[model samples]
Target chain A: MDDDRPLFFHVMAYADDADHDVIDMVSGDPDWEPPTALREGLREFADAPVADYQYPPSEGRGDLRDLLADRHDVPVERLVVTNGGGEANHLAMACGLEAHAGNEVILTDPVYPYYADRAELLGADVTYAPVADDGALDPETVRAVASEETALIVACSPNNPTGAVYGESVKRELTDIAEANDALYVSDEVYEAFDFSGRFHSALAFDSENVAVTNSFSKAMATTGLRVGYAILPDHLVDPVRTRHMLTNVAVTAPGQHAALKALRETPDDYYAETRAMLESRIEHFCEALDAAGAEYIQPQGAFYVLARFDGFPGTLDNTKRLIDEAGVAGMPGDAFGSAREEWLRFALVSPRADEAADRLAAYFS
Target chain B: MDDDRPLFFHVMAYADDADHDVIDMVSGDPDWEPPTALREGLREFADAPVADYQYPPSEGRGDLRDLLADRHDVPVERLVVTNGGGEANHLAMACGLEAHAGNEVILTDPVYPYYADRAELLGADVTYAPVADDGALDPETVRAVASEETALIVACSPNNPTGAVYGESVKRELTDIAEANDALYVSDEVYEAFDFSGRFHSALAFDSENVAVTNSFSKAMATTGLRVGYAILPDHLVDPVRTRHMLTNVAVTAPGQHAALKALRETPDDYYAETRAMLESRIEHFCEALDAAGAEYIQPQGAFYVLARFDGFPGTLDNTKRLIDEAGVAGMPGDAFGSAREEWLRFALVSPRADEAADRLAAYFS
Candidate 1:
């Protein structure tokens, strides 16, 4: 009963070893290097002498605070640095949801899957509110399922697997519900850079008290293994938890923080901009191929993923394996993303050269 | 309530802002650095020209695996490089306790605080049997609580905050009880290198299906900010929990792993010998001061911390604050560790120079 093995790892499993035609499409990992400015900044980092290796403040590096503060419009003290987007999600759910331990953590159905998986590991009871077949999280649906017993309301904008850019009205509704119930809203905005439709208001903007936004350099800056991310935490919830965070994993890697600080300073704008352009074009190309393949999806407005329905084709693990084994186009079944959409499959549009993915999709369908 | 601070960061926090008369007697962070030989080993890392910055195998780097295997006397596949020992411990428990989730995670009283805190966070009920008043986790106590419903037993040797080193006989006893119940034994040996007594034996030496050993370079190598540690897992448990390790914190830092690979090569043995000698003398000196101060504590056998009882002082947070404010010497209250021996305060022996702490302790008591 390895509950984790089959859970979504990445769209591609053996990507580094994949055959030319295997067409690796996996993870939210962007297949690119840090922006030019960020790389040049790395060279400049050597000058700081101390930048050779120094852990950031347990919460985050100061330069990163400035960048994130500007982007999220949150104060510096609210942030706490983590190893990556993964740790950010792990710690946010662990700390932010502390107000209502043992209560249900509400997650949108067709979730990123980690929200439930991590919440389960952290002892929070998980409840799901269904999104429409279009993959958009409806505010009414969220309201209908929300109760005083809910500990956290976790939703991702430019949602993973679905690519639904949650609207500002929906954001306000969720925030209002959380404010009323005193539950936290953990908005994972790792994909904030690629919001092709630009209304990227933070959940923090909606309400700071019940919101702890988590982001990372993994997607936009292409420094995933450098493993730097942070959560904007409310001040009152910061002390006793500080020791646990320290003792749980100790400080994050020193060089990683140093590199992240360099990246933020060197390419704060261009990193997100170039990645945004790349992601937008990839999403468009993938949507075109899906149309030609007669595959159905909401046509992603943001994020580097699309939930294409193989309504006619099989959506079982066997079908997913067949797609990889036969079509040579890899993807995770939408069924794994949600108990309801087993007939659909989610494809990660994470290719530095996504023209390859588009060609592969065309050839497979033909 | 800021339950998100990484464990073992306290040592660095204290070290960073070291005040006059400030003796950081808290976390088991060693006061040392990578040996000159290991520092030179950095050239090998830089020259090899591998992309160390990218994602490593979810298990770990190959050479590092070989080094860990050589050091721990375990097969390479049994090892997983983690962000730190806290992560290794969390992974060991998550993976080992898979079949026994709801059951009580057996931990000794006056615990490391982290063990109970992390286990509780992971949805396990934590039950404690008292260690000795002097802070040794007796084999007898571990045996008395061995139950079918007990998922895993946490044993810390050269114990944090206590400096209790479990003997060979005790480790064998623990292995026997855990084997009988088919429960896993996760021995956190982060303080492995600080053995003041030469009798340190690893639980990894005890042959059992349910035994996992976790240790870090923090104390032994004195690179807390580096945040590199590894877990030795046998064939049966590695696969189930391996994914969680990847999901929990992704990969350990590259430079830290490079540094740890150097730490693992124990050729001249001067650093370990010197660290042990220094720590041993400091423990002796501090205990003597405690004796003069009419305070009570077990003579520390290993590690860099000791739990001392100030009989008339009523070691509360208030007293701890007063000590920090007036005497400028800081130690941890026993209540922070576990419910047992709240009158006792844990003091770190890892000072920049030995006897500095002893001087502070003496002056404070007088």
Candidate 2:
């Protein structure tokens, strides 16, 4: 179903009209420099006589596949290039779930709407397993929700909204649950590089045949505009994904692909470390500000979001509109993430003005 | 299912060797400069702040859609954003062909392989209707091939491989055939700007419930690597296609979309005139060369491809291999296009080196 977000746009427009100094904390884009290498790569691509300016292989250029494979620690043949992890996840759910028309997808509750929305759009049944009080999935709970009619198990590690990275043991348990039920686990690891507490687990890392991993340059690389990502598919699924991607994009843009290839090849561990450092500091600042203000919240472990429960103002139903009307600061409403709790607001730690944003948010809650 | 490109990798490896001056004429990318306004728009965008780098509206950017709607003489709400026409076609096919196990696709023979391959991959029963002499469809032929079980009729105008733009009467016949048979007509007009003799009829221009149009920038703007195309689909089909596209690509790359918007908005008639002139000139030069070279061929009226038949070689199976090895010139084997006349070779008019290149081919044949 269409997410119907010109609704949010009207909110953004109203927020813009406010004369007060504004802090937009609802934005998902991380406040960080895209790696210098990525910049050079894009510039080089723009200048190159042919940075994939000619036709790329229908499946994708080998350099891209090889890099993706190495990163995933899989065979080069296991990867199929995609427009982004969105497509990767979409393809997996669309193609992998073909065995059953009404197969269930055990989506994490309070989830990235995409997880459930894509499944529904593809005509599959959805079973959202709400996060436990600890902000994590208990394997048994997931197992209870899945069924013989469940064709795919999808998870976002270093989860969106909550930023809870699945621990390895939990992932293994989920893997077993999927295996026992003959279900495919599709894990989105788009935010893997932002594991602030370092306990990131890939569902693919737990199992092979029943798991597919999808990743993208959107968050970690600060290249959301490029729309580059891929699925580390199981061998049998590669051809299907390739056909889908090719039939969809033909290939990603030449310049974007070159930039992606270059970024993947030359990314420094320090770049990720520096980014984590910034987010960690922002998280601490936000947590302290909220704590001082006596606001209820869950501190994010990874990803650049902090979910906090506000008593009277739970951010904005229309992104940033409520904040502009009342708080003078903007945040994503908990309702946006499909959380049962309607009073939670998300503060993006990626905003450069985190301290100012946090203070404004605290002031609003007060 | 993989398009069975058995010798695909071999040709790429051969191209990579750089030891010889191998001419790559097999690629469908025509040689032309992007419209100046498109470039100017990109320059403006490059200078604009990074805000445009954020998410696009699900319906597509309003400005681009407004212009596109104006160009098509359609209403703005009637349009939906797409990654490109490829996806528009795929989603339209998926939506048009309801959920079923054994749906069928009526494919034009020696046609664009993507239609047949994708339909097959999606589990549609792909049946072929032979392209008539001059690469146009006969109403009777389409009427004869359509079955009650058929879902999508994949039609390309100013057709690929064979450069014959289908006429309005033929489209009318095909439309009636699809309507009578309860099938959707998916039209690919990726080469809309290059109707060399000026007869590009959009199926949408006619009575259109079953007709959807797909087009791309690769051929028109000589930006093959940009990988941007879109479709103008029927109203009821909008949400399904939009959801599929958004789910496929979180969105097309911002810059590419920006560039495309600029191209359509800013590009002048002369820019198109020049592009047309270059292709028209190239077609003329090549045709004259082919006549002198004593090769039998279908004279192309539009699109940058000419199908030439070699008498000495009975099929392209040998001619393609021989041309690559002996002449170092590459045009796809006619068999690749599924023409019954296997001796024919499909030469993309992308290379301006036709004069010398034609001589080499003529000499090889002699």
Candidate 3:
């Protein structure tokens, strides 16, 4: 079946085509400088030998994979460099479905839409387990829905749209539930670098063959255009996913990987700290404007998103468009996510214009 | 079912791990310089605005797509930029299967292994239509294999391994056969720029709604590591393939695309002519050496490969390894392509060391 989820590009296009000046909060693309080292890396690659521009190992560059594996406390064989977190998730889900003896995939309600879209694309029957009102996914909800037919269970933290970071116990319990059901637990940790709560726990911490952790440099490095990311898969899943990756994309971009490796190695810790501080300030300012408008909003504990519910302004597609035209602001309709958040609007606080977007929303609603 | 095709990496690894210096002829990666403008493009992008580092349109960069659309004489909506020709082929095949009401796919007997691997990966039943001894595919063979159950027929012009360039008449007839059987003809033209013979013709000339043409910058620009490619698809297949590509790759690399765009715009025609001339010389030199070894070889009319059958030695995995160890030369076992070429060895003539590899083979055989 075709994916019925909202196309992000359509909303972005609407805002672009609007007559008035609109502060875009609909896109998750970070409006910040990538690390200086990344720029240097690109320049360095320009001078590399011709042979260096040929095919790299399909798995990834050995130095980069080895470095990542060391950082994650896993062997090099357990990881694969992918085109982006998108492909990483796709690979994990496809391999999970192939390895397990089932066709059903359990996902969180108010989920990141791509996860649901990928599950459906892979021909998995999807079942949603709704999270609590504050966006915390209770492992109990997952346990209640899981069955023998459940081939995969996908969870993201700090979660997109809602930004609830899963702690160690929650992650361990989710892994346990997946193992109990003979299913693979796919953990999307692309926002790991954005955790403000300090509660983010990687699924890799759990020593189980049932867990696959996917992450991307796009979000963390603020270089979404680079298309470099990876998956840390379990032992049994490694070869299958690598083969699938080879057959699908051949290999990740060699220059991108070269630049990523340079950035990963040379970027200072203070650079990340400064980014976190900047986003934390934007989040506080935006939440104040929401309070002024008398809107109920979840102040994200992690990640750069705020989910708000304005009375009499349910987040439907029509209203989302109306906000772009009349309010001079653009945010995603909550219905684009699952039913649980259908009455809310999700704004990505990645743009430097977050404050301007907040002011417009406050004024229009008032 | 899992693909049982020979892993190209394993062979390359064996050659790499060998004690002596080996002349590698197994990989099709070109050992030539990319357009000089590409390097300048990468350097220029290093100083680009911060906003440019965010996600590009998932389909591709707009300017690049428009340029390609104009060149191919297709509507921009009918084109999609992909990670590589590999993904372009994957998308075309998947969409073809989804659009048609059938499970069987017809392929060339000595096919590029990845096409068969992908068909099996997509769960399509594969049937082979054998090519003639000289590597010309007859439309009649495809017609004999076609039925109500066939969904797709794949063909490659300037074919890999065998290097057969399909002319206009053959392409038109193949497209006619596919149309009559209600199957999509997925024509891979990745080696479009490598055609030395005047016989090569694009399937796009047939003006059929059931044909999809896939090509890549990897071969033409000698930039396999850049990972940029595209598919010119039929109207009905465009949206489905775009959605699938978005879910799978998010997008191709930004800097790579930026460089590709610059190279495409600024590189002179002489650059391509020089590359072709170099390959033509290597082909002549390599064939003479093969003849000295008393090997019956198909002298490639186009592309950078030659298939040769030695008198007593069959091309098997063991023999491929032995050549790497003893002769200090590496070539692909013909069985990797398909059963029809099992007794022959395929050598890629991309390396500057092609003459050295040919010399090694001749001396070893003598």
Candidate 4:
């Protein structure tokens, strides 16, 4: 029942082999310009002294960590710069399992698949708590499923696929629930910058020791290829996470961090606002096409994904391939996430051709 | 008895806190300039299209993987580019344990600490096979430790601390031993480019499915900060390793891989030869100081470390700290490696101040 290969790669390979021109909506890689200062930083770092090319501190470059600490309003000791938000999440899960008494991890249904995959890789028993129909994970639902055996509870917001941004009350209650259950809550905020909803709230705002906030510049800075991210941990988890990070990755890319620092320092709020405006327009256009096709879709409140279900067209591996072949568009089948979303399909509005892809889908269905 | 902290960071922290000038001999981070072409590549990539700043293939950039596969004389399917040799080794060990029936891992005594740390982190039972006094692991010693329950056997050639390069015969026999024991042999060849003696041989020369060779450009290209490395896995292990890499790191840094690719394509043989020549001279000069100080030392056969023992100054943590405060030189306490070499201190000679540091050490002891 388990396909060890990630869903994105499986569908992507099929897309690559398609004879027709396929507009890719399956991958979350943003196809926008990165901050200009990031490129300038890369060029500048090409002339950095030899020591800068040797090794940054395992935790991270001092200045980058300091900047992240300032931004997050956490002490510098609470941060660890990672290879990406991927490694940050990996470290959090591993550390959570190690520190807690139980080997079980609680994840939201219609989950980001990597959370479940990583929990399994670290030998945790995973149990899913189904999200509400609106794609919001209720704290009560988490509390219902979580037991003393739950070592970790992982949630993402602004969420992937569903794009439901958890509000302050919801995040606070989830943190409290995890703390009561002796579980660590790993909140992936990688898409935080994409939140269009005013309700988006970080678990860090709750100031709970159980929460680890994982974020990356991949989505926000439009530079996933750079592979720079960080985990802001509770004081207790810092050392173990740092050591695990060191053993697993040694350190993040020096030049990437340098570029990220430059971008963070120099990129104006207008750049982010413009990006959000761009995505909002794409979302509006795509949702209109969905209406024309008579497909039911969750209008994303935050991240750049829309989950939709077309009547009589179940989102399965075969159907995903069919869409690539017949409709000239690619998307992730809902079953790739979890059982709760098996009849749905997820499309990332990352490509500039999002409108064209949406129109094609509308025409194919109509 | 477990400190949970890596020894390097512990000592390096003390070194950093020292008020006097301290020649850092504790870190293996090379001080040489990376290939000139690498800087050129970084500058060139600053102008790459937006797509290039998005995610590369999870396995790695295709051209970099192809180049590595060709260089190693392995099929492209055998390669999994990683964050560094650290992650490559972590993958090999984890995969080895998963694929084998046993949970026990055999490691060389005086081991690279990360090997043991990672094994424990993965919940494997670790046993040490002591190397010979000259710091060479005899195949028979490994054979003595092998059992049906042995999942992995790890070794490093041009070894850390001891600097003994294993020859072809020893490596071949080691592979045969692992195969006979139904175990995987992970050979860390990160220092392959630093072999000062003509004795260094990669376990890949044996062409055994039991062998996985891990290497990195961190040492060879002198760019540890770039975070680029790969593991040449046996056919059965590649898929699992690749999946683990994706879940853990997503992908290596695109810019770093681009730079590494350019350096690989353009670097002259003379560049490597000159590096080896420079290291050989340092080894010679450092050994001369050891003789003058009337200390016993293992003259390095390869790599850039010298393991030495003074008459009364044991390589304990206290003495290591004392050296930093008094002698103004920082070297790792050998006890940090493993119990087998607790009386010795390991000094990495990557600093341009290597001769001066050696002189300081000799005068301090005299």
* Highest-scoring model, DockQ: 3
Docking class of 2: acceptable
Q: TM-score of every model?
A: 0.82, 0.90, 0.97, 0.96
Candidate 4 docking: what grade?
A: medium
lDDT of 4 by residue, B89-108 (tens): 99999888898779888988
User: Positional deviation of B8 in candidate 2, in angstroms?
Assistant: 4.7
Write the residue-wise lDDT of candidate 4 on A1-366 in tens digits. 144355677899899998789999998899999999999999999999989998788899999999999998999999999998989999999888899879999889898888888987787899998988888878899898888998999999999979899899889988998889888999999999998988988888888889999999999999999999999999889988987887788788999999999999999999999999999999999999999999988888999999999999999989999999999999999998888999999999999999999999999999
Residue A324 in candidate 2 has what lDDT? 68
List model 1 lDDT by residue over A241-358, tens digit each. Answer: 4544565565676656766666666665765787778778888888888777777787776888888775468666667767777666777776666576778877877665566777
Residues A58-175, candidate 2, lDDT per residue (tens digit)?
Answer: 5667888887777678888888777777877888888788743337888887778777778777777888788865477777878887778888888888988887888899888877
- Per-residue lDDT, model 2, residue A197, is 72
Candidate 1: tens digits of C-alpha lDDT, residues B1-366: 223233234433554465555555555445555555444444343333224445666667789989888867788888898887878887888777775433778888777776876786666878787887666677878778778888899988877767788888888888887888888889889888878777789988876777899987766665566678889987887875566776567677665576567657643677788877877777788888888788888677887877888768866777776676666677776677777878887787665654766676677787
**Listing every candidate in turn, what is its Cα RMSD in Å to the true structure after a full C-alpha superposition?**
4.8, 3.3, 1.6, 1.9
Runs off by more than 4 Å, candidate 4: A1-6, B1-6
Instruction: Sort every candidate by TM-score, greatest first.
Output: 3, 4, 2, 1
What is the Å distance of residue B4 in model 3 from its true position?
Answer: 8.0
lDDT of each: 0.71, 0.73, 0.90, 0.90
- The alpha-carbon RMSD over the true interface for every model, in angstroms, is 4.5, 2.7, 1.3, 1.7
Per-residue CA lDDT of model 2 for B1-366, tens digit only, reads: 556244444554555564666676766765555566545554554444445655666556778888887888876776765666666677777777773223888878777777766787676887788886677777787778787887778888888778888888888888887788878888888888888766778887784777877777777777777766677877777767776667667677776677789888767788778878888887887777778778888778788888888777654555676677788777777767665546688887777675566667776776
